[model samples]
Target: MNQLNKILVLNAGSSTLKYKLFNATNANKTLALAPMISGMVEIGEVSKVTHKSHGENPKKMELPDANLNDHRSALSLVIDLLCDPGFGGLASKSEINAIGHRVVHGAERFKNATLITKDLMAALEASIPLAPLHNPANILGIEVATELLGDACPQVAVFDTAYHSTMPASAYLYGLPYHLYKDHGVRRYGFHGTSHSFVAKKAAKHLGKPLEECNFITCHLGNGASITAIKNGKSIDTSMGLTPLEGLVMGTRSGDIDPAIPTFLNKQTGMSYAEIDSMLNKKSGLLGLSGDADIRNLQDRFRAGDKHADLTLEVFAHRVRKYIGAYLIQLSPRLDGIIFTGGIGENSWILRNKILKDLEHVGIVVDKSKNEVDLTSQIMSVESSKSQVPLLVVQTDEEKSIAEQTFQVVQG
Candidate 1:
């Protein structure tokens, strides 16, 4: 029997640090679907830690007043929780074999999961300009993990933009001056690559084909959404560009707006660039249109006959459908599947119905009954029998993907 190695995956956001601990086979690096330990730390003036441990006897605990001001302190608290008898109760920190971090942007420098090192850390710092809002937090997490866990445990950086790094110049390059891209690295670098890559592999397996032989359009719809056109297992193009704000309409982001809108708002409303940036990134999308950011709340209002809510849903679906159509043409002549994953994509049948409606002419059809079925436990195809292509709802497991990648790097 292959020995099991403990792998910890951490996703550090601006204000939250989410983590999951998996037991993976040391031989093949196959990860267990259910994490042995999963939790998150909410960082602020008064921090909070929510923890869950799974086994024969499951356990859960919440520290509402965790004394953690930042990611470092929060991760220190996590170490304690892991060793505490009542919590994860591991023998010691040495039991953790490897750590995987979800680094949001790797730019063009790091295109694969890499072992964390001083030189790589320097490279990540240099790429910060490409992901100003996310990379710092991710770097902080890596630093803290290294500090607290020490050099005994191997650490790997799983990049979100790495999977999309396969995109050609025509897809990633902007129409701006060549020197801007050549000098300042101004170009599209898609996000949510781990999710898209995870689901695409699963979609290929579902279609009984190797990933390199399959062509797919993957839609990862959540608070932050993006679509990818996958050709022969590589990302040919994706919706998000440079930052995550260039793709589909998101929960709090005004995606795909005119490039001059910021300056226009600056000129018209006397709003500073920072203010306009804040408005677009934090106060737009469903929130901007329907006065709410949560899709469930927006759906509630829509069912209650709210016109603004109706428009919000329509705009969101329209943008997604538009991308689907574009990707269909991009991946023409034997597209194996169209996959929907992430929070909104997996749960919101109404939105899926809206996005897929009238797409039958292109051989895409959603089976209403199958679409409405609960997908919390398993992946399912919601496409009709008459459809030429399969429409799949895949449950994306990015943490597992990270763990698998991390284990591979560590083993090598």
Candidate 2:
């Protein structure tokens, strides 16, 4: 078996890049981490890099008119940072045993973590239209890392859609004609599979049950969000559809709108399809509703009697509650717990309280005092005595999951 020395996981966005380097050792196909290095790079108009190694203070460096015009430049800078003798993660780029990439859309072709290759890259290129906003950047990150680290360090892809591959046709299919799905592959391929899968296993561990016996509804409520319905460790259904835009209301994407709205807008206002698409994906959601999308900012304003913020919070919580109710019915008597992860889910107790309100009839309750307290990953339970179903807040570590998956592929 190939023992992992160091693994670097990269999540590349349109104009931003984030990476985490793990100090890991693999034995018998299991991987565990030690102290590691992590960082992020902003690649837009103004570029910056934040690098942090274990036991060292995070250092934020402003690149001098940084030429972060592309993923290559950003990755080159990252390699340089990792090699800096002062506080870098490695003395040489060659020390990295493997690199794992977070590819947003794998479609139906890639159902699990895959080792990157020339043929794999060609297949990923065909998946671009499915995730126009994300997969290109993901591929670019992989390409740059491959060029920088060379073929000696194996590269793997941990796809966001892989875990949802188990969803049945009834769950993933849309009402559209069968040909659309058969010919175009236009079906619900959910995003955030990595986070959902990782947290589901974590929740299973926390509940002291084998993952194959646990059922859960995991809420990943970050800027880009999705909720997954897991039955016995497999994703039976998820919120997001063919794209990440189909699920719950997020920071910007408008989720679950009427199907006719796009044509309606085009006919009513003579707007192009592209314009309407951009509006729904970029200008809608909490931002479109109240002009602010960050839950923190909206919550603060909501507390201060801002009616718009109040409505936004109510709408957001309502959507989440709606899904939880549906998933509860879907999972039925076997429903184990409702998991909360991601930014808003983990940090905003007020939102959790709001979501859990009036859910007691369904055996889902939250201890008010317990919910208000500081709960780390080790102490994830927030279940109320009146509740039969547990309310867990698991701090998801997708980077770690990626590294472990990558290790497995490299080991094989």
Candidate 3:
């Protein structure tokens, strides 16, 4: 029997932790009580945890409004809940044989899931400047897991930028000095690789073709949106640059702005580089365009005769359509279809419809009726009968992908 049958996947943020527990003995199955848990802890906020499991009622707990304080404290609460007789899934922490952590920036070094070693830990620390906001939290998660589970349980680091490591030099390079890329690792290392990779394989399976034989353009449209051009099962090009701030318009992120805008702001407004960076990453995008960052809110306002909302939706759709066209050209000969995933991509038919509009000349079509139907979270077809390129939508499952990858590494 495989000792690494139960796997735990953790995505730790500065103030939050999202986790999923999977029984991987028979194709990555889930526990009956609660398979996923999300917990939030901060200085002056009410700590909250939500649990969702298959074949059971979703449960939520509101902890005391006092400060839960740190990631370690928050993670302890999650472990407590998971081991609780009333809500826990496993009998003990020992049942979990392996843990998979989501590390956001792997630079150019880590191309695949890797076992966490002392040297790997040092490398992750060195790469901290590349992902200041994310890698620290990720490293903290691994440290806490190690402390709690001991050396008996193996820990794996599954990177977000790992899948896009296959991107060719032509696709990943910027028009900058060669020494920048060679010495400082300055290049377009796209984010959301796990999501893009999983959905591309899923798209191939749905089309009844081998993943290696298919081509696809996957748009992971969400708060942090990105588009990827997949050629023969590998990422050839993607929207996100060295950081996730490039690519499509996103919730609060100003994507694809003129490279000179930051300098212009600094020169004109006397804003520091840090201030301009914060504005672009936090104050721009759909939020800057229409005073709201959530797409659902923009969509609701657009339907109710809001002109500003209408324009915001148009700009968002236009950027996505533009990328779709470019990626199509990049993967022209064997172009399969365009896929929509993530929050907005999967739920917002209005956004998806606007994105695919008038692309009939390019062999892309949308079935108006099917496109408008509300889908809770299932993958369904919304392609028109005449479309040479199918429009596909899938709810991206990054945790599931991490769990499967962790199992593979452990089994090997």
Instruction: Provide backbone clash counts, one per model.
Output: 2, 0, 0
User: Which residue runs does candidate 1 get wrong by more than 4 Å?
Assistant: 27-34
Kindly list the per-residue Cα lDDT of model 1 for residues 1-412, writing each as its tens digit.
1367788899999899999988776445444545788899999987888999988898999989987788888888887788888888477888888999999999888899999999999999999988899999999999989999998788999999999989999899999999999999999999999999999999888889999999999999999999999999999999999899888999999999989889888999999999998999999988888789999998898899988888889999999989988998899887899999999999999899999898778888889989987796648999999999999999999999998888778878
Error of 2 at 404 (Å): 0.6
Model 2 lDDT per residue over 1-412, tens place = 3464888899999999999888887666466776577888989767877777776565544455675778888999888888888768687988888899999999999999999999999999999989998989998899888888888889999999999999999999999999999998999999999999988998898889999999899999988888999998899999999999997999999999999999999999999999999999999999999998789999899889998898888888899989988998889787888999998888989889888998777788789988986556543788888889988999988998998898888878
Span of 10 residues, lowest total lDDT, candidate 2: 55-64
Candidate 3, 50-155: lDDT as tens digits: 6544435656665556456777777777777777776667788888888899999999999999989999999999999888889999999999888888989988
Regions of candidate 2 where Cα sits further than 4 Å from its true position: 1-4, 27-30, 56-65
- Judge candidate 1 at residue 67 and give its lDDT: 76
The full ranking of all candidates by lDDT, starting with the best, is 1, 2, 3
- State TM-scores per candidate: 0.97, 0.96, 0.95
- Model 3 TM: 0.95
The whole-model lDDT of each prediction reads: 0.90, 0.88, 0.85
Q: Against the true structure, whose lDDT is highest?
A: 1
